[model samples]
Target chain A: MKPNNPLKKEKIWRVAAVLFWLAAWQGGAMLLNDSLLLVPPARVLQRFFALVREKSFYSAVLFSLARNAGGFALGLAAGVLLAALAARARPVEYLLRPLMVAVKSIPVASFIILALVWLSGRRVSVFIVFLMVAPIVYGNLLAGIKSESVQLREMGEMYRVPWPDRVLYIELPQLKPHLMSALSLSLGLSWKSGVAAEIIGVPRGSMGYALYQAKLYLDTPSLYAWTLTVVLLSVLFERFVLWTVKRAYARLERL
Target chain B: MTRLIDICKAFDGKPVLEHVTLSLAPGVTCLMGVSGRGKTTLLRILTGLETPDSGTVEDRPGRIAVQFQEDRLVESLTVGRNLQLALGRAYDAGKAESCLASLGLPGCLQLTVSTLSGGMKRRVSLARALLYPAPLLVLDEPFQGLDADTRGAAIAAVRRGAEGRAALVVTHEAKDCELLGGRLITL
Candidate 1:
């Protein structure tokens, strides 16, 4: 096992680097004497605290969270199901090949704009997030499934174990790591694409709406604050979800 | 009875088993072959997972069990669960617990297959095959990872398990023939 030093004094070098960068930002803001291009870190922090107290700000956070999370969950389900099907049947994979390629190649902004004409603004983020995630989940999961050792499957067959038993015992253990890889990559992508969709669609009273309002009104501090809030939420949610997956893996390794 | 007649197996373009004929009844039989000489292929053919180019097998009992050259066990499941999967619902926990006890693997039912040493996994696979209520058992190098003492016990367990059933074992060890009372067939 490796040494455990969560935040040793050695990290002080990194801290110094961070502090130096922040000082540089403050100096640049002072020289610019303008809030439009960039606001000082202190003012941004102030606006962050101010927004933290507002109930509507919490609602905005919740709104984006709900849509993005919902989309991610749906994508995960569909991707696994589709990958399983595709793995077992060549016809299914052939049918899906074109669609998966298109989904992978297309840009997020294109999809967001195209979806706006068809879907309600409130649902655009969900659709965009789902689109962004499904192919990654599908491709990685299918690859994972394919990489499964055939020796294990043949042993299961010789034992005459039931289908469910084979899936639970032989297939699942090999599949878990691949599924985790898919989830880690797709979760971050969904957040980026989901929020971008929201900013463009500008559904009423969302985080995107707040950011846009701050920009239009020249409230640089509020805009910077909201950006920070989005960044924080994205990081926090990723950590929480990944931590759960890692715990599951640790438990499985002991099984 | 397990019968293979006119068995012909080929890979790519070359033939492995050509016009081969064999039969095995209710006894321990050892298959001896050179490395890469297609012992695994023949075993796979017996399991119906491989197709011989021109062969017909008869009396292949359903619910047959195999302990392949490789462990072929889920490396993330407990030893007990591995045996349970092979043995089906007929597995008695007490019986399984006792078997593991005798095999020096007691109190390890909760341990995952991945955490086990190579010898431990070999024993687990051996135990799984022995516990399964199959009319026929196929084992390929089942003693590969066992120490001398463990090998003796595993040989005894296999003999007891194959008392009224047909078994096919593949091993290069000469003592394996004497241990299991196996009739030798060299290819």
Candidate 2:
């Protein structure tokens, strides 16, 4: 007989692992014997279905999603622009070094609290998310730009390759892995920091606010449901963004 | 008539090229040397990528086509796109295809450089140099990885490409100079 497909086997193993975890969670919840302390996975799923039927749930999801996405876009643009400037000029890199270090080292909770004091609750999540994302992108891309091959650059110079062509053909290919890494790292952090800021700020009509309400009422099932919703949304957003970028790279390679 | 007069270059106080004077005319000139003989440094100086510690370069061409020792190709891109990147508006698909075919890389325009074998990538790099329109051509170890027959074919192609232009080629083999029917300059 022919060997089994590795990809299919891997998929089956992954599914089995997930089922095993669910069973463990169910067992742990039963042993606890307190719904408030540990709601079972089945109850949480039921609660999630019921919560999804509410119009307020959609509003909350949309509100959090928009703020996180906006903050991520702003961070991405600023990081790329700063990285380009830093790559071109040594002084710019030095000037940004301290700021980037500070941003990377500072605590997310501290930034969220500072943002809350400076801005309204409605805007805190966006600010926090931006702060979380910019430094990661800037640092990774700067390294990528610095690591571009000297030999290839000399080849471009010798041939008098135009500025646009040099960037498209030489620089972009070298930077793709760095760019993807920055995106993957910053995207997950954006969601985490964005939701943390929202919960602290307790912005109305947001997932964070819904989570806070669930906590305030000591409703374990509702809290689990909202948490699951945020995770699903985050995962879907990451997949979509990564897929779009990969497709664009594929198109460029074809060209 | 490009000339290097009394050129001297050193790295960390060790001399690489000292008081080297040479002239390049409109024909193929094959440069032969052992390893660590500063052949690449001379090419770099001629191409203005490195400024000699002491020398005067006269009438250097503003544009030159160079094939560096390494196949400095964009690994993610297709062969045609690499040619297009270097040649810009001067790129002709028909000319490029035929040039690649002549270099023994037929039907390789659509293949990504990363997928190609070492010899194939070398030819692709050579094809880029040949296709680029310039007054001077500089190739460093252009026939490094080719077999004997392929090397002969590549030599013929390089000679044809060097017509009406100055070609500076660095190679280890004295036979390459005889094959190209060019003057020999040893560093």
The estimated TM-scores of all candidates read 0.93, 0.97
Model 2 segments beyond 4 Å from truth?
A1-3
Give the winner by DockQ: 2
Top candidate, metric TM-score: 2
**Candidate 1 lDDT by residue in tens digits, B59-141:** 88887878888887887788878878877887788888777766778888878888999998888888888888888989999
User: How much is the lDDT of residue B7 in candidate 1?
Assistant: 89
Q: For residues A1-255, write the lDDT of model 2, one tens digit per residue.
A: 643999988988999999999999999999998899999999999999999999999999999999999999999988999999999999999999999888888898898888888999999998888888888999999999999999999889988888888888789889999999999999999999999999999999999999999999998899999999989998999999999999988988999
CAPRI rating of model 1: medium
What is the C-alpha local distance difference test score of each model? 0.87, 0.93
lDDT of candidate 1 at residue B15, scale 0 to 100: 83
Q: In order, what are the TM-scores of chain A for the candidates?
A: 0.90, 0.96
Clashing residue pairs in candidate 1 are A255-B112
Docking class of 2: high
